[model samples]
Target: MKKNWMALLMGIVMATLLLSACSNEGSSNEADADGGSGEAATEQVLKIGNDQEPAGLDPHKVPAHSSIRIYEKIYDSLLTFDEDMKVQPELAEKWEQPDETTYVFTLREGVKFHNGREMTAEDVKYSFERIMDEETASIAKSYFDKVESIEVVSPTEIKFTLSEPYAPFLSYVASTNAAIVAKEVVEENGDLNQAAVGTGPFKLDEWLPDNHVKLSKNEDYYKDGQPKLDGITYLTMKDESARLAAIRTGEVHVTTLSSQSIPLAEKSDGVEIKSYQSTEYSYVGFNVNKEPFNDVKVRQAISLAVDRKEVADVVWKGDAVLSGPIPESMGQWAIDVSQEELYQQNIEKAKELLAEAGYEDGFETVISTASTYTDMVDTAQLLQQQLEAIGIKAEIKQLEWGQYIDTWTNGDHDMLVGRNSSGSDPDRSIGFFFSTDGSANVWGFSDEKIDQLAEEGRTTIDPEKRVEIYNEAQKRVIEQTPNLFLVSPEKFFIVRDSVDNYSPTANEPENFNDVVIME
Candidate 1:
């Protein structure tokens, strides 16, 4: 952990100063199709900072949020979600759903990747098939589990044949993982960990792990002089305070802040606050296969004991919304389990349940969290206190982000606070955590009924029926106690006042390319 922290500090220092090598130099006079007449000042350089550092440079091997952000900046997908969170054209100019189980994407014409290689249907098929190969170790493989095969119909057209009627297929491909890559580069490098090539608005110039990544605007970008900034330097810093300080000091142009840091930005000059509802939902997941936790009464008791509102207010500074497993932002698909039916900090009910479950004397348990998110640490500590009050001997362990996540996914702990970034669709969020074989299901929870409902929701063609199926699944899940659904926190961003057009989006990592400095 210390080594990574030091590396992150070094990365930030280097990112702010070092200018990496560029292969091509082009005129900046190209018109901005989005709006501007290519008349912006030529001195634009956006310095973005974040609290987390990429575990590695490989998008295929590393699924961490930090690395994906870098990948998104440099890669293009067959289709991408627009600002409205609807599927829009990217590498694929248009697509058609010929049947319930098959969809065809038409590749854009004359699209050249950073390597000057023209994007063809074969490259698109290769990128999709690679992510599904278990050897690639992509976190996105689970989402594409139903995909049967990818066949190139023509140089400009590719067909995706799925084993089942998957409603979210197109949106799934629109994910950051499905970002199109050059088949030539991946074959030559034979190692995704060291390779980087894409057709996005920027080209990766240099990646110094943990310190910084430098990306110059791709001159041959398909969108034509898109990414208005001359170049973007992503500085990885672990300290939230340091990151906020950098933004205010003008050491960096933008940085993300935690809920607690919102007040600091609100009070400070030369800083702008941007907030949006995050698809993320916080929960306390119990290892349902374990001895005490296996008893649904015991799990419900723990859920009832903790005060979620108190934790959200005191720890998060009331910057978040109280949410169950299904966040309200999910809208129509959101299932209202009701605050009364769910846990509500009732000590008497918790004690009653504990006694009913033959654990009146309480039991010993361990709670785990990562230090990268200080709020998680605080939440764990509070849970420890609350559980102890119920006569349960609770211990808290703080692990580094990498170790923490690995341990959680490997099912090595009793319980942990977890979150999932719900994508554009509710099915995307619901199906991932509750399904029996879900890769992110850390609690080892399995229920045939809930699994069936989730599957039904996924394949159900009718919107109303899908929502009903998902609602039933959510109810069953909330009742099972694998999750003590807590709160939905807002995605907070603090940037320099000079930064304009920083519209916050539903996506956790919103594009900062739209931003420009007043100077």
Candidate 2:
């Protein structure tokens, strides 16, 4: 009897052990079915080191480049540009031009804002009206000068009436400046300079001024299974060295690398460099309203003095292409005019022109630039040397980006070393700078012929005719010498190997909505 009882006890113990083992196996399988581990199940975050802190959260108020880097992820424009630089639908599912001066847009359905409010045509109207409002003082207002009125036909349909037949209106709508904002949110948050609420792939989570801005994935994003990453954090690393260091230490997943730092990044472990042909060109812009620079001969002389190839080879490490007033990225709109005579380094000709311009002794002037832009600073220094060689005393005045912008916009500087958008369209690229009332015409360059040509180009509906008009305008601009056209530097991004689908556009900001992280 004792043996039988012991056998039974042993059987029970064995049965219990077997059941426990089965339960443990099932739990493991369940966990695996859901996601490998707790860590894997958790949200994936991507950290990026932005070269500079965004000036403001309001897309309408800040500089397009830096602000768009942030706004592109937070807001949705009526239209968006594709890889081919073609206008594609974004918030507007479809659009049509009923007439030369009328555009009708149909909004996407089932789109919800971050505040759980449905987007309507009225919101679009309100957003655009806000930009056009004199009280708003939106920097983007100039871009929409042709917009006469916006009519909300229905909840999903809207129409835009133009004062003239503006050919670049569609492209303008696709630009960062035309990003649609939630009317309710804008109303609630008067300025929207500090906070943002939109129907983008991500929602503003937190903003630690001068440090970082955190964004979380919008679960209710219009596109299904989008914004693969759970969140993104943009760490403001103004110093290029600090940004590179952050990338090396894994503090940041991606950051833009200067041409000089490309070698360093290439040698760094677990770093990958991706290069893109950018639609941005660096140029030495002259305040045409100022002395010496006002003379076309002086401008042309300075343009001839600097060797663009040397600048490209030395300052840009031969990673840039010599560009004209319009970059080659403008497709058919870019006319390859023979600037050989003007771009050639002719010191004697430059001196003769200077002498003719009443600067026989060579005058001294300050070249204002932003210190944060290392490439621009280097280019400015190189330009200073070149100008000195021509007997012109060029003083480099590097200031903080904010101050630099202030001084440049106020037309307080004699010369400005900076980069400007060589947009996909002629109006956006050339007209913005050369047009009589151009918003970016801080140089005070005004020509009736150029203005008339720009107007024709903007109003012409035929692509070929528009191109012809712009080509003429470009020729005139080159002759006027408002800017000493330089090299268009290729943008280099240092990304981690683990990051997937991290393609950035030359014209648009980096989009991380489709990015995913691999273990």
Candidate 3:
């Protein structure tokens, strides 16, 4: 019995050794497929890096595109822009303008939120109401100022009633601000900021703030076989040099580059640099409600005082176009005005205006800007020196990006330097800022005639009529002089050669669904 027991033990040991050998062989094969060291195969994952991380998962709370890009993958708006930069169908497959001031949207059928709940018109209504509701304190509330009410027609249909025939209303619906949410889930959880549930192609699987956010493809997405990659991992790198270094070392795959660092990207092998027409326009906004700027003469004086040509060449590397209030990227909508006439460095004229405003000696003022980009800080410094040359004591104050945006949004700054991207359409650029309640109008500028023309531009489908209205509005903005329209900065994106399907997207929210990597 002892000999039989010993033989059984030996047989078991030999069998165990064979099984271990087979397991090692299988793991090695998987590692070979993964292109990693000999280890177990893992699901395919793509890594991306962005300048900032998500502030919140709630669509109403996320103001910046950096956060919206992540939220966009997890949420679906009533409408979405197509590759041609026109509003097409998303959750809302089709729609109709029942009247000049009303829009009705027909939601797509057979769609499910990440939480397995079927979307309904009530959810859509709730989403809009939530943003407009004062209790929510949504940063994008200003964009929806024209929205009177959102009505649910049925389970898959909804109507948006506006105060006027706003031309950019539909486009506003397509913006990151009006993105849909799981109404029931948000109501139950009371906070969607930590995690989001939507009908987008990808689901938010994990989010580690300041470190990484992971999104897994939603197999039950309305569109089938979408989100080509198994999953996406977005990492945030605030430091430009560190971000560039990370991409060089294969730590991250894609990133947005500062205007100055673009050339370095072009010189690097296995990297592609793409330039796009950004709707973003830099300007010096005067506090029209107070100070020496309250005088139209002082405002015009400042507009003519700054050397736009020099600033464009020095700060933007001569890759920008000097313009009036209206950015030239608007194409046909852009007024056919001469940039040479609209903007020129005329210190003599500026001094004259200052004298008319009763400040021939010039006045001391503070210019507020974010310290994130070296270019922004440098531009502020340059502006200070230029203003000082004409006896203007300009004080430059650099604040953190968050605080700077808050101060500007609240209209607390005497003078602020910034830009706004026009997006795919001219209406987004022209109407939003010039309109009375435009959230972006921190300068607190308003005009009934200008508002009327802007409204006409929105409702009149006739191309010629629209151009006439926009042209007149542009002229009015120049006369009011709340802002000194400076230059439009060129946008740049850099990706490693290994990253495929990389291209310039004029619109800020790029479609990353088609991006792929080589094996």
Q: Write the per-residue lDDT of candidate 1 for residues 317-349, one digit (tens) a residue.
A: 887787766787878878664454655678888
- Per-candidate TM equals 0.88, 0.91, 0.85
Give model 1's TM-score versus the native structure.
0.88
lDDT order, best first, reads 2, 1, 3
What lDDT does candidate 1 reach at residue 365? Answer: 89
Candidate 2 worst ten-residue window by lDDT: 34-43
lDDT of 2 by residue, 1-519 (tens): 999999999999999999999987875664444334312324479999988777778876666466678877898889988988889999999999988999999999989888888889988898898888878877667778889888999999999999999988998888777778887677777877777877799999998878899999999998887887899999999998998898898788899978999999999898899888888888988988878888999999998889888888988899988887788777787767446578778999999999998888898999988899898899999999999867899889998877886886788889999998776678866677878777677788989998899889888989888888888888788878898888888889999876766777785548887776644
What candidate 1 gets wrong by more than 4 Å, as runs, is 1-42, 188-191
The TM-score between candidate 3 and the true structure equals 0.85
Q: Judged by lDDT against the true structure, how good is candidate 3?
A: 0.75
Top model number, TM-score = 2
Model 3 lDDT per residue over 1-519, tens place: 999999999999999999999988987775454443445314446677677666677888656556777888888888878656688888898999978888999998889888888888888888888888888867567667778888888998898888877666777788777888877777787858886898888889988867899999888888765765678888878778977877777677777777777777777777777778776778777878887877888887777778877888888888888666567776777774444443667888888888888998888999988776666776788788888756789889887766776787688888887766666545555566767766566788777877777677777777787788777888888777777777887777777665555466665435666555543
| lDDT of residue 146 for candidate 1 | 89
Number of the candidate with higher lDDT, 1 or 3: 1
**Could you give the C-alpha RMSD of every candidate to the true structure, in order shown?**
11.0, 4.2, 5.9
